[model samples]
Target: MTTTSKLIHGYEVVIGFETHTQLATQSKIFSRAPTAFGAEPNTQACAVDLALPGTLPVMNREAVACAIKLGLALGSHIAPVSIFARKNYFYPDLPKGYQISQFEIPVVQGGEVEFFLGDEKKTVRLVRAHLEEDAGKSLHEDFIGQSGIDLNRAGTPLLEIVTEPDMRSSEEAVAYAKELHKIVTWIGICDGNMQEGSFRCDANVSVRKPGQPLGTRREIKNLNSFKFMQQAIDYEIRWQIEQIEDGHAIQQATVLFDPDTGETRAMRTKEDAADYRYFPDPDLPPLHISERWVQEERALMAELPRAMAARFVADYSLPEYDATTLTQSKAMAAYFEAVAKACSQPKLASNWIMGEVSRRLNMAEIGMEQVPVSAAQLAALIARIADGTISNNAAKQVFDALWNGESADVDAVIESKGLKQMNDTGALEKIVDEVIAANADNVAQFRAGKDKAFNALVGQIMKASKGKANPQQVNELLRARLAG
Candidate 1:
């Protein structure tokens, strides 16, 4: 129910998302078929999936458990009893004429996803998350005039998460999607892989004038990547506004995003609930859950991201932003904790991980598990800086060498590079005295209350010391000499 006052081309865009999260299970939803990817066409499907006679669908207990885990993570209501229904549709990809899904009541009901959009907090409400079986993929490649069907993905378990119309901009939609992705993956329910179709998003976009009725929405389907998701929504908003301005009414339909042209094209007319002809499945019975089971599952669940972030704030004395960023992924949080524990400098650990480490990881397009620099090596490097063995810039040089695998040992790199700070008081005093004697005019300017002159003198001292002098010591010594 979140509304925005911002407008684009004198129209406000309304957006909602429907995300399908594939459960991380070894078997299909109702059969014993393996759920591994990249198998040959029609290899993984089984009799139940093919809807052969004398075969009845059996519910996957693990899939239900995964749904429960997601509900607990999102603070949703886990229904005590839910029913399965058959959604009748005609598509070449669907082996069974009807697809089994939840209707009237779903396992998860009414949750909220909260995320930050550049310091402003936003929340998106959930309509429901229902368990359903995925249809097979229709492949059009590798054939001259005919297409092929890959039923390997048929009968795969999917949790369709429907959201209320809350997002107003493309950025907010992306943020909300990312937060949802993080939660699902964090709870060990979904893999959150967009490449393999493990996670998919469909955005319902519309535009209207301020305080006007909601416009007809066209759903952009199968947005596999966040970049494409943002692009598709932005384009759709512009297109809808343009259409309305030209006195053409918006049509409700399903659309596809063409990444090559950066435009969305209509696929087919959108179908309402009645179009599917949903009815309770005669084969499957009502799904029932007890309070004891819910409590047991909750107890076994790992600490959630928000709770972990709060703990980091209270225990490590970290800023809220630092805590939140570190807890974005479980692997990242573990790496930060290891570094902080090894060095006993929580703030320093947070800074290094958020700064240089994040930059390198993003450039390489890899996860924290693939980081070239280990926690132990980073902790040792931070220790050198903390003990004044090297300045910040010098430490960065040592870090670069270690990261590039030039040297594995921190102390060795520091020694080989000759990055040790100049801590000799007598040597520093001599250089300071020479600079003061040579720059009498600059010294007079400093005495006349010019701060820039003093900074220039400090810079000269640093330059004379071959960039090895302790900057703080130089500042203190220069200030004392000038005052005297």
Candidate 2:
């Protein structure tokens, strides 16, 4: 639901997001080690990843390509030259004692992510997106009171996407994050598996009066799921409002959200740029990208969602809403196109896919690709409807049979279920005549201009024929007979 900015105890909620999208590179960003998930601990860590003595970091070209693709996708500016800096920090997982990341200069800058909250269109402005390496994981369980450090994730390529403080509510923040996830996964830049920590969100939340300067913010780190992201931001917003009401000054700090309790607790004081001691990495030279390279990459890129949606509207004459719904996923769009082409009925194909197909998919909690009905099978069923072999109501019965795998073929299902429409004009006319004679009150009322009476007469004809008659044909014949 789209929620407007409402004052909570005379304070407005302000939110910004920082998302880390793990690039789908086969290897680490600066090392030749494998970047596959679920590997045994420490197996993917190499000399460069472990930051051993005399080992130097090498930039992965594939990772750079993925970053470039994202910049182009988001309409961001790809810096001609970018530098990597050492982000000094200390932790059990930080084997190098400092992380190599972009400080002052990032590769992609000034992008916007657009999404819809219910029917409201919202756009979140992006500050910058930079390429960085993921740190190792700290295993706490099954260690007998001693935590073990797993360097497998260390040196993994990541694109840290930072957004401006544009979202006013947790709903808008979650919507923006979901749209970003769709884009990254749609463009093949990231796998976007939240459970595996491929895409992580950090929301910076604060509260203030309408005209007041931005309040002190607390950063909620590492929200992996959209559900948790919303819960965390909601709890943080309430907490800040309560703090201000109680005359407690909100402080800048890093916090972790406990999903089980639906609360955010301060983890530590938030560090600023000065605290990190950001400096240019001496071992790695400045990265450069030529205009020709950008163009070449653009040429090889897939058609984006927006452009594809526009084409669907123009070529297929679909409404903007239907086009957008169909293009939500590439597989769904392709399936719709195939059905439309095979049946030569774009509007009908769109309606069935958006209505019946979508309903089933949502109920089963599966994607369009997992649908049991094939495009050809759906087209064949649509063809039966268009050729007047079956009425729409009958077609639905046939569809159900096909979807449930009761019949392998559309024609076979229709034939076996005896769903063919009663197109015999003589037989349909006799049924309509019989209904007219039987329902004298309805016919008289319909002639007296009661529209419901006419509909009742049509329903009588359908029942008389055991629902085998074409509804349109019955209406036409019944109206003519009554007029005569």
Among these predictions, the greatest lDDT belongs to 1
Q: lDDT of each structure?
A: 0.93, 0.92
* Model 1: residues with Cα > 4 Å off, grouped in runs: 1-5, 444-450
* Cα lDDT tens digits for candidate 1, 1-484: 4545579978998999999999999999999999999998899999998888899999999999999998888879999999999999999999889899998999999988877777676889998999999999998865587788889999999999999999999999999999999999999988999999999999999999988999999999999999999999999999999999999999999999999999999999999999999999999999998988899899999999878889999999998788888989999999999999999999999999999999989998999989999999999999999988899999889989988999999999999989999999999999999999989989999999998999999989999999999988899899889999
Q: List CA RMSD, all candidates.
A: 1.9, 2.6
After TM-score superposition, the amount by which residue 95's alpha carbon in candidate 1 deviates from its true location, in angstroms, is 1.8
lDDT of 2 by residue, 1-484 (tens): 2337867778888888999999999999999999999999999999999999999999999999998999998999999999999999999999999999998999998988877777677778889999999999998977587789999999999999999998998888998898899899999989999999999999999999998999999999999999999999999999988888889999999999999899999999999999999999999999998889899999999998778888999999998778877887889999999999999999999999999999999999999989999999999999999999998899889888888989879988888888899999999998988888899999999889999999999888999999999888998898899989
TM-score (C-alpha, index-matched) for candidate 1: 0.95
Give the local distance difference test score of model 1: 0.93
In candidate 2 the C-alpha lDDT for residue 327 amounts to: 80
